[model samples]
Target: MDVTTPPASGDGPGTAPADFTAAASPGTVTLAWTAPATGRETAEYELYVNGRPTTVIQFGAGAVPSGRVEHRLTVAEPTGTAWAVKLRARLPDGNWGSFSAERRITLVA
Candidate 1:
């Protein structure tokens, strides 16, 4: 695991998009995010759940200029009351930007 540099403060081109949605089952949640404004240099995105390396999804060839890019994630076969899901950008240069605000969803019984 690589340590990422702290994002710029005061909202000076350093804010990530917020993703949200409710899951139908326990330990599951929906995810979405706007691409990083400053981290356009990123190559791929690393989706994380509860601070762990969860998934690596590839970004298209086009440069991630700015503004939001939304994505959806599902926890297969959830097994708990709720789940925490987060998404982050991974630059092609091996630098990771900031992460989206974590979201919590309850599982259906």
Candidate 2:
């Protein structure tokens, strides 16, 4: 998917990403979610790990409101440690939305 940076303002507040899910393997986790319906384009998505912000991205081109976005992340921490993750996005139609529900993940060695 494509990605870009835009100001965090819109006509109305955007909705949160839905159906967040994760899968884990040795040292890594794959995260996925359905983006919110933000109209024309999907704005910036902020990824939080362990309760702290980690990354920001956009689901370029197609993955806007209803698209499913998937991300693979490498966690250097030891396996079995809980990884709490969530996402907040700047909706193209409104201000940044609240983060999606938290998803806890654990890597497997």
Candidate 3:
């Protein structure tokens, strides 16, 4: 996980994480993004894989610009498979921001 560099910050209230990226390695995929302004206010990040709600990322979601986040997952699917990913954050106070622009990655060895 790399947080030393800041990605794009919030465009405005209710905005999604900034500069979301996904990178594929032999058997794992790494996802990273810059948190939103309200990230620290109590939010759960939802990871979507292939357009389905996959899991809730335990890492903080709205950590501001300096709280860039990175998560890696092991891939069990076959190589050359296509992985489409998206992210959105849900706040305990009833705020579900928009989903981050989708990122695509092809699995490789």
Candidate 4:
């Protein structure tokens, strides 16, 4: 079992399709993503915002408990700025997969 990051833009045999979903609630942004085809079992999902990584959530196979990796990111105070949510998968062997498409969303006050 080989674990690797997702391929760079225009750099993979096939473009792995990933889903970036966001749900705005009273005080948090529920973010999620679909799994990517990395030829290996994924162990977790890493989330990044703006240009910095925020957190890495653990995932278990069949534990599809939620099926999707979710992040409950909080807003300090709803600033009118666009935030980029990027996702990456971790292989069961401990290798980080490539990042999925960047999803940008704005917070309206």
Best by TM-score: 3
lDDT of each: 0.59, 0.78, 0.79, 0.67
Give residue 33's error in model 2 in angstroms: 0.7
Q: Compared with the true structure, what per-residue lDDT tens digits does model 1 show for residues 8-105?
A: 66656654444533345443354555666553445467776667887886756685434555445454654555557666776445677677777776
Top-scoring candidate (lDDT): 3
RMSD of 3: 11.3
Off by over 4 Å in 4: 1-17, 23-25, 38-41, 60-70
lDDT of 1: 0.59
Taking the tens digit of each residue's C-alpha lDDT, what string does model 4 give over 1-109? 9999986677553222277787666557788766766665456777788878988766566664343556676776565667887777766556676777787777654
Error of 3 at 103 (Å): 0.5
Deviation in Å, model 2, residue 8 alpha carbon: 25
**Candidate 1, 76: how far from true, in Å?**
2.7
lDDT of each residue in 1-109, candidate 2, tens digit only: 9999897676664488888888889877898888777665565789898999889866566554457877888778776888888988786655778789998887788
Model 2 C-alpha RMSD to native:
10.6
* Candidate 3 C-alpha lDDT tens digits along 1-109: 7668677776556568778999999999999987766735434688998999999876444542256777789888889999899998765566777899899999988
* Per-candidate clashes, comma-separated: 8, 4, 2, 5
Per-candidate RMSD, Å:
7.9, 10.6, 11.3, 7.5
**Which candidate model has the greater TM-score, 1 or 3?**
3
Which 10-residue window in model 1 sums to the lowest lDDT? 19-28
> Cα RMSD for candidate 4?
7.5
